[model samples]
Target: MRRSPWATLTVLALAQFIVVLDVTIVNVALPRIQTDLDFTADGLQWVISAYTLVFGGFLLLGGRAADLLGSRRVFLTGLALFGVTLLVAGLAGTPGALIAARAVQGLGGALMSPAALSILTVTFAHGRQRNIAMGVWGGLAGLGGTLGVVAGGLLVDSLSWRWVFFVNVPVVVALIAATPLIIRAVARRSGHGFDLLGSVLSTAGLLALVYGVVRAEPVGWGSAEVVGCLAAGVVLLAAFVAVEARSAAPLVPLRLFRSRALSSSSGALALNGASFLAMFFLTAIYLQQVRGASALRTGMEILPMGAAAILVAVVTPPLVHRFGTRTVQLCGAALSALSLLLLAGTGADSGYASHLLPGLILFGAGVIAVGVPAQIAAVVDVEHHEAGAASGVVTAFYQVGGALGLALATTLSVSRSHAALADGMAQQQALVEGFHRGLLVAAAFAVVNVVVTLASPRIAPSAEQIAEAAATA
Candidate 1:
């Protein structure tokens, strides 16, 4: 019997949701994890960073593997590994063990994410079907962050922090059992080799760069250790680019940047991601630190944003159809900038109902407006065979932007607080000063996104045109 395409898409979407949720789930659980594992103040970031580094580093390689090996095979293998990793992470006795397990989970996610996306690209015949499918995919991806916070709060409050990891096991098991019946098998392509050197250089360079940025607050930018890591990271990335230019089977095809829409959309996405991640991290902290809210209250307070985002995501396709992708994206960027500006006014005395909710709604709407169009534009011209790789590249940069954004916000916040402390300001005043500085930085990043979005190509292909191109490819 033939498998149902809808079933395949459903399973794939669920898998993707799980992977993305894991990326943010640990945020709410950080305090709990710290208390249980005896983690130092600096070590708290590692819980999130460990997963991000491995996931971002191997994503290109994972996409290539899905193409060469076989999507179904890789998908199943990744699911199994992911389940095991989650189990190990949940059962971990020490911080080191948990971090290692998180890294392993990231490896599995890198493999699974591209494979799931590749399956969707092939299974869903392009046109309105593909557009709707992509919209659902994008929506689920957006919802992952919100659900992570809510779910993490419930689990952490009701059960143990380990339940956060354990919850993934049943989901993985169900997916593995049903996958064969839902997803069709694609024939494996031949004549491709792994770009091992390129992978190594890219991964190591990114890890080093992130480390340097994260440590800058404590060690100071002038420290030899920080300088050495940053310098080495740059040299390694340069080498990676050189290798890609010369290699027969490059992990990242430099030619992808030739398309103006693709290039501009990618740049805009990086900036957008930086702002979105910064907002999430900062808001989570603000609710806890300033308002003295519990995890549940913080998660609930942010529910308005998620609700607004869902409404926008639902309306976005028709808006794009009417106004064209470029116009919608430009509008989205402008609105996001305005949202950030509004958020910058938030202070200790501000109420969520009066001050924060409006900003949250605007932020949600703006992000959906920009996010959908930018995502669509990024993959507009790619061949079907390269769709997975294209998606991988976009996701990688998004994660990179997220990690760097958090580090950047942290740095600004710390610097402002430090200066205020040196000036003999009250602790509360210093913290508020830091938060304000971070908000301004985030707003600046969003404004940069506006410029990048404007540079995107004005031409918007119809659903029919997109389907025709995919069919021929």
Candidate 2:
């Protein structure tokens, strides 16, 4: 008896949901974790940054592993690692221990995310079903991020902060049990040896680059540590590309980017991620600092945005099918820009119902609209053999983009606030002005994505591409 495809999708989606949820869920619990574990104010940030850095760093390697070692093998291995790390993190008595666990969890996430996506790409035919699946996948990705705030607040308020980590344990256990029943195992690919040099270069380069970027705002970007890391990362990545071009069994085949759809999708996803995360970051500040909302209240306020995203996610696939991918994506980009513009227009006296709610709703709708189509486009042209690598590439772009965007927003917002204060402006007025500037920066990112989307070749599948996609399924 064969398992239903939807069942397989459910298992995969749940794995992805937890992976993404973990990224943000720990945020609300950070203060509690710090209090309990005696973390230094500086050390406390590692709780979030450790996971992000490792997850982004190893994604490429994880994806390629799925291709060579078999998705089922990698997926299960990642799930087990993730589950054990959750336990360790929850029980950790010191900051170092918790940070270490979080770092390892990031590695597990790196493995699980790409493997699950690779499976999805091959599981469904590239048509309406695939589009719908991508929408659900994209929606859940956004939803997980949003819900993390709410769930963390509720859990930390009612129970202990450890519950944030503990809550996912049962879900992971269930997924591990269901995975073998639903997803059939495949033999590992033969004749293709791992590209150890490329993997080392790519991983080191990404880790350094992400570390530098994340540290830039806290420690000046021009500081020796950040500069050295950025320089080293760029040099190492360049070497990695050179090595990949010549390697017979390259970790990431250089040829994958030749497809207009794949390349454009990668760029578009980066900008989309930049705008989305920047918007979230700036809005959180606006609510908490400007409006004097509590952490729990802030999460509750953002609920409408999540609701809007869910609605748009359901409708976006059909919109893509009807209006075509480019048109739909352009529309999404437009909505994102409009949302940012609305946010930029907000002032200290603006009311949530009148000023914030509408912008948040549009943002929720806009991001999903752009993301689902862009995600679908990313893999539509790739061969099944390289699907994992392709998935890894696009996902990596989104993560890195978010990190870069948030860093930029923080730096600019702070700089602007300081400048205003130096000019004798009131602190509240200075902060609001700084936030407005940050919102515009996010809007600029959205506008850039619109141009990139418009310039790319349309993603309508050719008959040959459609046939290839069908064969993959």
TM-score of every candidate? 0.91, 0.83
Clashing pairs in 1: none
TM-score of candidate 2 relative to the true fold: 0.83
lDDT of each: 0.79, 0.79
Weakest lDDT window of 10 consecutive positions for candidate 2: 464-473
The TM-score measured for candidate 1 stands at 0.91
Candidate 1 — number of clashing residue pairs?
0
Q: In candidate 1, residue 60 scores what lDDT? A: 84
- lDDT string for model 2 (193-289, tens) is 7777886787678667766765665578899999999999999999999999999877777899998888998888888877877777667657766
Model 1 spans with C-alpha error above 4 angstroms: 38-43, 93-95, 126-139, 181-184, 381-388, 422-424, 465-473
